[model samples]
Target: MNNVEITRAGLPDISRIVEIENNLFPDPWNEQAFRDVLFYYSNTFFTLKSDGDIVGFITAGIEDTSEVLYGHIMNLAVVPEYRKMGLGGRLMQRMEYEFIVSGAEGSQLEVRVSNGDAISFYKKLGYSQVMVIGGYYNNGEDAVLMMKWF
Candidate 1:
């Protein structure tokens, strides 16, 4: 099996990451959004590469927008061809380590409520459902608010 390389998002890697983003999400981040990430954010974006190809990625940030600080996972996507492998978990474990490096002691994210497989995956990784968002996705799909403490 090929080894996966995980690192922070870098300058020359935006195009392939965008390709995966577009193919994975209906409301993908646009060009400016991506540029903002690559140019402006340093600690929030991380990518996983396999055989020098961008296969999966995870985006997270400090949840300072709320009253208290927390690590918040914004996005986690693995290309369909690469699913069923442990790449997603690996990417998440790396992101969590980075979040703790930045002084965050806990993390939170929302998962689509209907995605039982994803929910199981997160739970297996020690995440617990804390609540539910009524209309979390663009299509009004519900989402489960899950949190993990470091």
Candidate 2:
């Protein structure tokens, strides 16, 4: 992890972020989605770079309700070669810290029910499955709604 850095995402990183998104998910987010996150929630959007090349990213937003302010992790991805190196965990910790700084009481995210690896990862981060969203994805895959209290 020497020389690896996590920095706020900028407009220029969109193309590479989308490229990584397209490669990882069956229904990946488009360029405009990444743009919207950078435009609207830049405070919680971040990119991980190694040797000056973007290798991973996370997009999150803070949502306030009557009872609680929650941090929503909308998207996260790391280049295939960068997996299993703790880069993803680093990105997650960064976002969680930002959430705490922003006065959020907890964080929430959705994961494909069949994605055992992702679910396990989130669980390792202290997130627990709260519910299942039926037909959550465009392909009708169910999503497990997970939450972690701050």
Candidate 3:
């Protein structure tokens, strides 16, 4: 993690973040979506930089319901060259830490059901499957909802 920094993302970082999203996911969020998230939920959007280059990012937000307050991880991804270097896990840990500090009781996220690697990764991080949502993606794929209580 030498020379790597994790910081709150700004509008200036949207283009690079969008590039990563497009490269990693089939249904990527557009620039406007990133802009909205940064504008409305700035506290939960973060970017990872290595040697001054954008390499990864994670987006999450606090969800307040009548029953409970929790954190929802909306998106997370690292550039291919940065994968397996502990960057993803570090990004997740940072987000969860922020959530915990913000009084969230737990955190949740949805992963593509077909993404076994991601499922395993989340599981290793102590996230367990809570439910499955059918047709969760624009492409009609299912999503596995996972959660972890702090």
Candidate 4:
């Protein structure tokens, strides 16, 4: 972890990010989606590099509504080889810091209901389960909505 570097993701990083996404997720965001996000939320998109290779990444965006400004974490993934190395937590912390500085009142994300490990991870990060959305995923998996207020 000490040797890992966290930096804002660039256009050139999208292909690698898409690779990680496709490998880790049941339904991954395509290259175009990553590109759109990088274009629109560059500040909130980050990549973790170790030994000059991208090992993890997180993407977030500020959702401004009439009632509040919320940080919406869209996607997060770590290469299989890099899992459980505190890299994901580091990415979360970095994204949270950006949300705070960007005037977000809170942060939110959705995780698969069956993913207990991820749910516990979010809990450890101070997020509480707010609701469950049925058929949230393309494959009809229910999603647990989690939120944290800063």
Ranking by lDDT: 2, 3, 4, 1
In candidate 2, what are the lDDT values of residues 1-150, reduced to their tens digit?
Answer: 468999999999999999999989999998998898899999999999998999999999999997999999999998888899999999999999999999999999999999999999999999999999999999999999999998
TM-score of each: 0.89, 0.98, 0.97, 0.97
What does candidate 4's lDDT look like per residue over 12-60, in tens digits?
A: 8988999889989989999999999999999999999997789999999
lDDT of 3 by residue, 1-150 (tens): 569999999888999999999999999999999999998889999999998889999999999886888999999999988899888999999999999989999999999999999999999999999999999999999999999999
The residue-level lDDT of candidate 3 at 44 comes to 93
Model 2: residue 111 alpha-carbon error in angstroms: 0.4
TM-score of model 4 (CA atoms):
0.97
Model 4, residue 96: C-alpha shift (Å): 0.3
> Model 3 — which ten-residue stretch has the worst lDDT?
60-69
Which runs in model 4 stand beyond 4 Å of their true positions?
Answer: none
Quote the lDDT for 8 in model 1.
Answer: 87
lDDT of 2 at 148: 100
Candidate 2: minimum summed lDDT over ten consecutive residues — where?
1-10
Q: Cα deviation of 22 in candidate 1 (Å)?
A: 1.8
Candidate 1 residue 66 Cα shift, in angstroms, is 7.5
RMSD, each candidate, Å?
A: 1.8, 0.7, 0.9, 1.0
